[model samples]
Target: MVHSPLKLDTPQEWDLSDLYTDFDDPRLVEDLDSLQQTANQFRQQYQGKVKQLTPEQIVTCLQDLEQIYQKSGYLYAYPSLVFAADTRNTEAKQFLDKVMEALTGVDNQLLFFDLELKSLDSEAFSQLQASPALKNYQHHLIRIAELRPYKLSEEVEQTRNRDSLTGRQAFIQLRSVHLGEQEYPDVTTPEGKTANTEAELSALLYHPQEEVRHNAYSAVRTVIKEHNLLYGYILNAIAQDHKIENQMRGYPSTLQKQLIEDQVSEPVFTAIMEGTASRFDLFQRYYQLKSQEIGQKIRICDLYAPWTTQATPPLSYQSGVELLLAALEKFDINYARRAEEFFLKSWIDAKVRPGKRGGAFCAYSHGKHSYLLLSYTEDYNSVFTLAHEMGHALHFAWIDETQSYLNSNPPMVLAEIASTFNELLLLDSLLESAADETIRKSLLTRQLEDQLNLLFRQSTISRLELAVHQRASEGSFDHLFINEKWMELYQLLCGDSVELLADHQYDWARIGHIFFKPFYCYQYTASNIVSLACYQKYRQVGKAFIPGYLELLASGGSQDQVQALRQYVDVDLEDPATIRGALDYVEGLISQLETLI
Candidate 1:
């Protein structure tokens, strides 16, 4: 089916009516109220009776609990998605806050369900797990059981939930609003056009002209520097909060809580960190090759500069969609068809608008379809971003189809596999069809650069996060300390291949994950390694690998992540050789690029 190209000037926006017609939609209010009342009823019925309930009774209670959460999730997602599309929307912000507070109340009332389950004696918990009626929720029950050691008093847990709105969540929102409201000073592009707005300025960083790239870099860094103190304070407060909670929850270290939540072992994380760190020379080697190919010295600003002076033709959003679908079709027709629903049904917001959040994410809930947000610049990178988020959306679609709501959310360690794997499929399809050598070189460079960013740079960010938490553990830290540590770690990563500038110190503040989802960056490294291995297996097995891969996505969080990967992809997270093999694959890519250049 041929499709007309979506005009570059008129960006595509998502139709959010599927979630709510408007903030004032009667269903929204009804659902919000219904969620609270249902939760209240659930608490009244099961608050102190988890241990005493029979397996069938527990199944009944769990079903009610799932319905309550599914409804609450439906209500919360609407306002949050609204705010994400436009942070400056006051109504959305207020609605989101109201929903959050109400949900916190609901959550506090329902908290005893998990607490009581955790408090159960080992023999009784085993009996429940062994029941046929409880088979579906066995993994869920085991996960909660693992948290028994970290369970705080119900009162303390409630206080933390209530405080988060103003404490951690409020600070995170401040950063988002601040970034949304920023009006970057316009810089002249190499094409003699003016670059205004954050996205435009970011695009200019890849401009062929060195001066244009520097201007864009400076413009962004200037804004960040102005607000460094505020960002620094927020980071410190969040870290300190984590420290306090870590102690209260009896976590031995700051990273342990997140590691436990991800269902990843400490040794696996250590292996990834060490594996990527030991290969910094490969990172530097790639930059040196890039410098030679571009015929200019590499600088912090030039990190994203195009490999050649000749620019690749801009890809229309429609063209990008068609290209992505073609790639997915080649991989699996069913996968392509699932992705097509997103475009046809207006499930994506790809428009570049003021106050819209930067970067990209696919928002999903148990009872509703997913919605994606991204500013679709007419570039290959934007195309890859589209494919990536679609991967997430498709993964959630499968989960909704195959798993119960209670078992639907995959852990962070395995979450990026499908998305990153989609990227590789797209890359391979593009490369196979490229008729020009320059375009082919450009694609290879992109593949290599993306791996470096995900594998190397993310590990570096993880190290920086570790340092920050360590500092907070010892004492308080400010912007100055964070800035120095960021530069120090980044410079070590770059070595002598790229020149680091003073403004580069503020770059750490730009990483929203470090502030919002502490210790989350390492998952990217872990997922990339696993995804690359998955892609390699697909390349070897061809169509034979598709069923198991699709089954893996459908499995959702129904099993242990490590066990799931082993069952489907046949990859082992605990093996050091697996990490080494991934790094070896990266090294091979670098060699391929070296030959091309």
Candidate 2:
């Protein structure tokens, strides 16, 4: 029988030294003042003089801005991540909110400079691009210029940014107080014990017993249903807010605004959607096989059931890090080393304690350090989760060292490539190293399950989102309609393989990404397909692929994702062939699994 870790087990605190001496360290003040002074002077020198500045001067301005922004980013990221780890901490939250306001005040003053620069005549802008350094930012400048058509008066734009922080951001914060901190009822287990919180409740669902899964699922669903109105209002308000903004921005579709921010095209996104949806057979078939393996007909609720294997062996902190580092070594020695550094330096916050947020994420702190937050499970999935988040951490680390501040993060769409790629490598390594056929089949099934969730399941959600937004555009948008549509998509995919339990119908309530970011789910499919395509090249091309991949990461926000991805790896997202290639790879893997099974 499996036993839970004892409560009050101390979480290893991450070393904050890499960020600063402390949140109130004198260097932070010094740097902030220096940044403000430079920005103030930068505005004076280039405010009206941008069109007339020499190419050298423009490059110099870009460089200075990059440096200052990078430092400020590091400053902000540290505290924000710390606060996220302990959302209940009043002091950290207040301090972070204040710093955010102060920093926003200074940064708001400089917003006009870029908009004004983008307004420069073509000839003058062309002259500024003569320098190699300035030329490197041409695409970056061009994107800034693309906003010209939608540009408001400088006063209006500035007002919007400030008002957003105060009005919209503040509302979201207040809403979080209501929704984020709501006390979920204790999840009663089948053994007649109540889990302390939702995190523990979620952990218990992975119990090998079917009764535990059913009870946990029912209890969680009960809480969500009890609070459905509050959650529904939050979701609808956010979606409506996005829809209105997209309209005002003249974006062609609800997601177009996000795509523009992502620096990708509509057709490419369509290809990702179409290509991923076309491969539903792979997921359906896997679920079918999994259902048979589990001795029950699979249904939507059964998607996350645990494989009967050795119970989660007690994996100490060091052992977890060593296992991840060892698995990562197969991908690249450097990646392995970087992963090790993240652990050794305490870059991760893995204590599975109460009141901390559930799930995992890598917070990029620009130039300082990336922080990972997870209620770490000692199971195989947790190992994969660590590897996944580390992929993001490593990507940002490389970008932080190489790119300027404005260029540190790629769009969220491409951002997942590295993370998912890491997952693939870890899964492949574990599969290869498994000791027996049963274990191999289990690993294979698990990997396939993840792919189904990330690829087919996520794409299905994205398509439903697109449909909902389109209906909203026509003024027929309703939450009930969205929930109904979601159920339809779920049934279409799961059909006969799994029973469509009634509680499973409200699954969309749990997917925060959908409520938080419109059309964000498409990226999961995009990242997986892109990773698959890139992985294929890496396998066939050998060491030659690494340089280009690094170059792509280094390029960061300096170039659009499509251009950077194309220039480096040359995977055309718009091409049917590329999508077909990825789908075919999945089919081949499935065929291999079928043989083994």
Candidate 3:
């Protein structure tokens, strides 16, 4: 039986006019000019006076600096968002490149402020931090002071900043444009139709038919494999660039710089990595159970296949929004109210089109609201993704409301908390209202699979990153080295449970984070553990849990994240028990699924 494609009664694209009318908008030119002028003026006034200023004067300086950045951020956000929505737009791409170059120059002029502040003597810094006028900016000041040891000369810093446009940034853009413009060949879908576009092919991974899943997976792999050489060179360039920067900055390893930026200690990161690796058996166990439930041996492509033969009904975008809003409202009405603005204001670009970037993200600027991009395929997974990105938007909304621009962006570890917490909430709402035992089982299976993906799969990616960086540190590497390392780590996690195809070795090229944001995947695992613990506490305490969670979101980067979690959400990242408990919860989930099966 063939069913018609679902027609969504929802806005397909975002109205970016809230940021700017278009590439030709006069405000764009005005803001760019103003941003550059403001930076120059700011530099002349405060470039060399950071240390001589009194505490109150320091406060005034910071406020001024914040204003400069806020303007620059507004300028950068518009073009980047435009490019992301359609990378094939040559005009948008040109505008974005121009904005980035301008911002780099502006940032070069302002680099002196941080250098001067970081250069302050211990006694003088202590005196400044002690002042009551610096209370709100205390954490911001501390972060700068912590990086004092890694500071390079002002001239070198500026050179690096300028070079990045054609260096790291250019390579990143190359990968994006290459992926965005490549036309994927249409593959057969489970419904006897065709899956065209990367998003459609990806959605077919969950089809009930194994043949459909294999065809979809193989088709994607074939394309990526054809371009493996380019992707390989891109990854190699990025890793080598990181290594050179790490050496220049005196970072102990390639990962240390990111860890420092994230405000996470090496020990905490090690614990999470080891904790997840130690539990690989649980990942294999879940897959083994899935195989039993499906009554067949499963391959890598079958990992996301539904257990039953009947295809799950397609979820319309409108229904997806209603479901997500209902789940969020049940958690907190204020959360629901804030999310509604994304739809009413057209802040989300959810249309499936060629040249739009694949996957989903919520991009936030300092003074404006967040914008989300995703190809909504009208599936249950897409609804969960909507909730996840909405969580990020709501998180930024709280930060924008409560914190100054200087303290608005949280570290990546803290950044992922709200998004994953939203997933757990959606899962709870789904399991509670599931119509029958089969539905409940499917939901539970999805939850378990999500955990596996977030925990085990992400850890594998992190390990692969560590390996590639270590190899790059010694010398340059090519595609073969990357493929071998990826497969080695991947097989370690999968064990004998899932069949590893030859094309699976090329899978590392598909992960944008590895090329774009170094060492970013591990945060997903850490945040998953933290979110699971938060959701457990919410379940135990009920309404009493609301204030602390909201306070955590509102805190932003105003305080140290570990302390913020302990103070607000009551989770300790430093303790081994926290990691153990999260792992135990995952194991318990597997057992629950076993009983359901």
lDDT of 3 by residue, 59-152 (tens): 8889988998888888888888888888899998998899999999999999999999889999999898889999999999899889999999
Q: How many clashes (backbone N, Cα, C below 3 Å) per candidate?
A: 0, 4, 0
> lDDT of model 1 at residue 478?
99
**Displacement of the residue 187 alpha carbon in candidate 2, Å:** 4.9
Off by over 4 Å in 3: 1-8
| lDDT of candidate model 1 versus the reference | 0.88
Give the alpha carbon lDDT tens digit for every residue of 480-593 in model 1: 999999999998999999999899999898899998898799999999999988898999999999888989999999999899899998988888888888889989989888
Give TM-scores for every candidate, taking all chains together and pairing residue i with residue i.
Answer: 0.98, 0.90, 0.98
Worst 10 residues of 3 by lDDT: 1-10
Across 517-544, the per-residue lDDT of candidate 2 in tens digits comes to 7778878888888888888898788778
Clashing pairs in 3: none
